[model samples]
Target: MIRVRGTVGAWPVDLQIELDDQDWAALARQASAEPATTAAAAARPSGDDPLWSRAQALLREAGELEGPELLAALAALAGSDQAGKRLLVRLRHCDQVEIVQRGEAPLYRWIAQ
Candidate 1:
């Protein structure tokens, strides 16, 4: 059984699929046929990813922005709050980003490399 729960374009999605033995075998076969490099490349995020590139570009263009404000923009771009939050977390840990506490809020600044 495969369960997927997430949002797609502002819509919440919850799905479950139960696969039989044959289906599982077929899936395993397809996965094993793929090149190891392809799987590894897909798992790692890169500038080639559109959402990641755009998220970085948005922060770069802003120079600096408050956490909530930047999160709202990212949420809009990502089409869901959860997705936006994921991007925000990534930005918080990014080498090019500097985070500072201002009162109760966080300020995210893009440091040019």
Candidate 2:
């Protein structure tokens, strides 16, 4: 099962899609068939200024947000999990942000202007 929460045409959407074992296996096989180098080449950031600017804006606007929500939003903005993770790592090193343990998930808090 996969849960998706986002906006579609200015309307907020939250939904879940469930896949059978066969479907899961097919997805796994398809992922494994992809070449690592191809994925790596695609993962490389191209002029990251826009992405970073948007990221900082999101951090400032959110003030404080749960980790999973932040990840999902970042992934949505970035268009890929790899890119989202990269953004999260970059945010982690920023002086204006802080991530702290909060129960099972971390919380992202903006600490500077």
Top TM-score prediction, candidate number: 1
| lDDT scores of the candidates, listed in order | 0.94, 0.88
Residue pairs of candidate 1 with colliding backbone atoms: none
- Indicate which candidate wins on lDDT: 1
Candidate 2 regions exceeding 4 Å error are 1-48
Candidate 2, 1-113: lDDT as tens digits: 99999999999999999999999999999899988888998876555689988987898898987888888888889999988888888888788998899799998999996
Give the distance in Å from residue 72's predicted Cα in candidate 2 to where it truly belongs: 0.5
Error of 1 at 39 (Å): 8.5
- Candidate 2: lDDT of 13? 100
